[model samples]
Target: MITLFGVGCLVFLVVCALVVARTRDLLAATVVFAAYSLVMALVWQQLQSPDVAITEAALGAGITSLLFLLAIGRTRRTEDEEG
Candidate 1:
């Protein structure tokens, strides 16, 4: 029997992917993208690749999300000024 935690994580990953695709706000999408990283890390842990999973958590959930949010912040000003 598949653990519910595993199933929920898998479902969450799919949902996050869809959220990222459908979200209109850049900040919201970046947050969902970060959620995708976290879900991927959980999947990696389930697969026994703790090292890779840790790296993904740091890069995908941490660094990449911060970078995207920062970029969005920078660009928001430009968009606002133009509009």
Candidate 2:
């Protein structure tokens, strides 16, 4: 029952995962992780779980990204003052 689009999304998910893992910059990794979460939300929608998709989109992509950005901003300022 797997379609081509599903396969493509899966491949993209793997690539995003690798990029997030290899990236050393926290901000860059957070952006990529957000993208990965959005794609995962799409995958969940494709799998017919609209509730999970909505949750992932809201919590994983939206709130988590915002929280990570806030944390990065605070830590960067602290590091700058110390260095």
Question: Model 2, range 1-83, lDDT digits (tens) per residue?
Answer: 89999999999999999998776677888999999999999999999999999999999999999999999988862223333
* lDDT by residue (tens digit), candidate 1, 33-53: 998999899899988899999
Output the number of the TM-score-best candidate: 2
lDDT of each: 0.87, 0.91
Each prediction's total of clashing residue pairs, residues at least 3 apart in sequence or on different chains, is: 0, 0
Residue pairs clashing in model 2 are none
Which consecutive 10 residues in model 2 have the weakest lDDT in total? 74-83
Q: At residue 35, give the lDDT of candidate 1.
A: 87
Off by more than 4 A, model 1: 77-83
